[model samples]
Target: MLLCSLVAIIPLLYSVDAEQSLSANGKVLELDESNFDLAISAFDFILVDFYAPWCGHCKRLSPQLDEAAPTLSSLKEPIVIAKVNADKFTRLARKYDIDGFPTLKVFMHGVPVEYKGPRKADLLVRYLKKFVAPDVSVLDSDSAISNFVEASGPHFPIFIGFGLNESMISKLAEKYKKKAWFSVAKDFSEDIMVSYDFDKVPALVSLHPSYNEQSIFYGPFEVEFLEDFIKQNLFPLVLPINQDTLKTLKDDERKIVLTFVEDETEESSKKIIKLLKAAASANRDLVFGYVGIKQWEDFTETFEANKKTPLPKMVIWDGDEEYFSVIGSERIDEEDQATQISRFLEGYKEGKTIKKRISGPSFLGFINSLIGIRTVYMIVFIVAVVMIIQTINKDDEEPPGVGTREQGDNASSSVSEAESKEYRSGEKED
Candidate 1:
């Protein structure tokens, strides 16, 4: 009987494995509450999309995930792509705090982190590959170095140390592994040095390929300076403000010297960015970013910018609810833009700027809320429910008349019971 039971379990276990393999075969798996836990547990790294079937964005993302699934699953350290119909599995949705549809999270060893990377097929693959990549990739040749940078994609900053020992950057690499990519090229030529714009070997070069920028540091390689350089170069010299880049700023503590232009594509705007880049290089203590009024009217409005405002207006934002604008350097002339920008920084450093609160809710509030309209609905509904409950509880706790002692005791007992039940319900939900 025992032998027969073992034989029965063997095929059952094999069939379960076969089922999982079939679901993951060259396509994203459609998961639900029943199988979500098991599927997540089976993979070392899985990218899960919490989506609603009726969501237009989710519909659009489905095919992209299908196109990327095969390539990602074929990697040496395979990454499985899966999705859950969050609308159908509401409990699972709430468990993961899915306030919006088409939410993406990458689960590594059963721990999930929000996926803020791109959603396009090719970009998604490149971004997910970074999660599984080693902290510091060792490049043995110039060809390897080139290939590594090419494969690193354009999203994250790349720090490559030429002719430097791996031990020097190992700890730093491990520390900032999530924020940027780190590597050391053991073999390279002078061509590499010229390509990276570094004067000598034993130098660390930080590349922001997406921004068409690079910076070199010939350092003592001490933890303080190296870490400082890495943190400062983690972002481009002049970051272009957009929905995607806004999310990246949440972790940075630096104040932004943000410029607002009429239109980013205009040559005039490019000149402003060039000047801003120079200012940024000199003042590494602050972050410099720019957004076009026409490009993002809503965000510009927060800074009290509008059509009547001078084009290429500048301000120093504290990345929260307030910003500073220098009095004399309020507007930059077309010809004297460079001089005006210098004056703006000088005035700011010398306390010649006025501070004012941003006109609207924080920019990061929108980012944290994830999807816009639906999240607003959820928040409104939650607040309404809480208000109603509080009103009811308040009515129950109203003081009894002086003569109604027994009635007051009865009311207190009922209120205590209700509170106990509410607490128990919260415990069960948790």
Candidate 2:
């Protein structure tokens, strides 16, 4: 009987879905005193909704909690929901000081912050936002859009596609505010959109004022993208050296070493810059300059989107004659980069051979491309192969028979008397 219950497990899994978990569309995982530590440790953010099975408020709030679950889950470190049975784990009530049913205590990253009673979906979203900044913007008018566009510059540069309603630009400006000089074409005319030809709203255009290599993004952007761009692009090494300054050097003399990086997190961005700086110091002719992709994206609407690209990208445009770049996988190893930079500058002064790497996607685009198209193809192919093999194997297996003809010769007992009409009819009379 127990083995029979396990036979249809695949069918059971296929039938399960969103409705199984309360009214709210959330993946509700149960928790109590025994697994409290495990729940807390498993996720960076834990929201424990403590309740009694008999409580009316818990039922009323279940759907609302489910509604807010998705919004909270979208943050960098996702929040896990833990439902606790206060009746069974009475100690938990005393621990959290159970004054009421439907108590929610957010934990992880140290001490628990508790809130008693139930809440609406919006309110719950608001509460979660206080802890983790969600990707959302307040866009209502022209002034708001203009301010964000202009403000993006000192913060980096601004990239505003003019012609768009103030609300749309406001949204984009609020997002990519940290990395690029603002680029705009407000009229929505062909001159702006056609010349740039972007389908997404409030696109970004990156600009490296020094190298003259502008980067552009023709899609919606976020603060996270800008944050990363600022960190990656603005290094003293990538800082544009003035052409006038280079005239001071001998004729066949100077080599520029430029390192490119995305707008990565603060910690990682700074570490890479420090390493690049050391390498640049050892080489005399190579001038190191850093340009954040986000910073340059102020003109993203104009940057013109290219699907293929790579990270921590570097390009050396040797005084208008040749520009060499490399962009496959990012190593950031000092010696490797130093050797590459030296090679690129070889022959000039035992200059390094800088592999001219080009046409790689931005980190975000690269990831999206990897997960979206490539992952889908792999999943489909694997599933198709598995299903085909299963069908072939089932066909190869012979059927088992519980009863046979030829009764003791077996036919005598198997076929009945009266022209064997009884047995023939029972076997469905051919």
Which candidate leads in TM-score? 1
List model 1 lDDT by residue over 5-88, tens digit each. Answer: 999999789659755564556688878876788888888889999887666677788899999999999988899999998878
Question: Number of clashes in every candidate structure?
Answer: 0, 64
Model 2 C-alpha lDDT per residue in residues 216-293, reported as the tens digit of each score: 454344555643433333323334332222322223334565555555345555566666666664553466655455
Angstrom error at residue 65, model 2: 1.3
Q: What is the C-alpha RMSD of each candidate to the true structure, in Å?
A: 8.5, 23.5
TM-score, candidate number 2: 0.27
- The lDDT for every candidate, in the order shown, is 0.83, 0.48
lDDT for 198 in candidate 2 is 55
Error of 1 at 394 (Å): 22
